[model samples]
Target: MSRRPADRQRARVYAWEDRHVAPHGGDLLPFTAMQPMVNAIWAELGLRYPPAVEPLPRQARRLQADANRLRLRVPEQLPSWVLLHELAHALSSTHDGASDGHGPCFMGLYLQLLERYLRLPMAQLAPSLAEAGITWDPAAKPVFLDAAPAR
Candidate 1:
């Protein structure tokens, strides 16, 4: 089966994770654990799955146009699931009206995709979701805040 764009992108990110992130003793559990979830989601949705997994930064941002085109910036510090979640945002076509923000609907859809694709219970995923620092608020503007200054 042909690979989906999101899955291909994910694989690229995973390679980055192994090279840059893993050598530094970075934890890959979050990224490694989500594959089955993604595959499950693909099966449910009947979308083509990719071979590689990419680990996206936590503070990544995605730009979307009405035509369903997306530009993603993968953060080095972000977990792979978070990156996939943002990709999910694009795949599901959950965009706010005119403004670029992750609103309640977008977040809800993200959660639904996570559940369906990741085969994870909502409760099990909540902590990971919280760790990824994703918030759902339609009125809020999307911003890429700098990581906290190192101590």
Candidate 2:
């Protein structure tokens, strides 16, 4: 799994996100605030079930997500952009995403999630993805991207 392109290149992914998407979706939230937000993203993306929002794995040292849970570091790193990245993981896990993990499909969903949730313009996102060497499909967006998140 770690040998996969996206997994191996995850540093580049973080770098890409840092340079391009930072300061865009960094809305900080507490644990109480994040559950509803996570559920909302699940519903918006049409995922069958949202993962449990839990505390960071102590060893994770970073945001983590899977089919069953979205583990986060509380107090310090609770940002929307971080949620978007992990949500993409949760979404991908539902679609048999284990094969590629953080590969194209996952990153594609992350980009679309960014587009939908953060309103980040693809005009800006597209070029940076290339520059960052993070491959993404423009058309890989879900239908929910066209609609606004629940209010």
Candidate 3:
């Protein structure tokens, strides 16, 4: 007898994303709290403009640079790391005009934001990225500004 499709197929599995604990040992930050933080960080980073945070129809988080918006799945818990990644996209888009999408410019911007603003250690971020099947070059240096303007 032939096996049914369901029987033949393996169970569906989703990719594992890195879960980060808040400084106080809490889970992800709610949208209300996170949005303001994004705005402040954007200003602190001296970006030309701040992106608005909006609800995304789907469960994935993404940055829409042209619109200057960050779309995130609503009513879903989002790790701080994930939000930081999206902000990196915003920074890359605004500051980097030379490198193409997700190229060296993007990586440098992301790493700089992660280290400078988020205070995330390379020790932690690198491994988390590797587990997600993304390879990051540790030698990539972040572009520094002459003087970061105060918000």
Against the reference, the lDDT scores of all candidates come to 0.41, 0.66, 0.49
Say which prediction, candidate 1 or candidate 2, comes out ahead on TM-score. 2
Q: Encode model 2's per-residue lDDT on 1-151: one tens digit a residue.
A: 3454437657888788888887787777666877788888778766545667776666664444333233333443477887777777665553323334566767888888888889998778888878878776555543223333676
Say which candidate scores most in lDDT: 2
Backbone clashes in model 2, listed as residue pairs:
none
Q: TM per model?
A: 0.34, 0.74, 0.52
Span of 10 residues, lowest total lDDT, candidate 2: 65-74
Query: What range of 10 consecutive residues in model 3 has the weakest lDDT sum?
Result: 7-16
TM-score of 1: 0.34
User: Which numbered prediction scores highest in TM-score against the true structure?
Assistant: 2
Output the TM-score of candidate 2.
Answer: 0.74
lDDT of 1 at 5: 35
Task: Please give the clash total of every predicted structure, in order.
Answer: 14, 0, 0
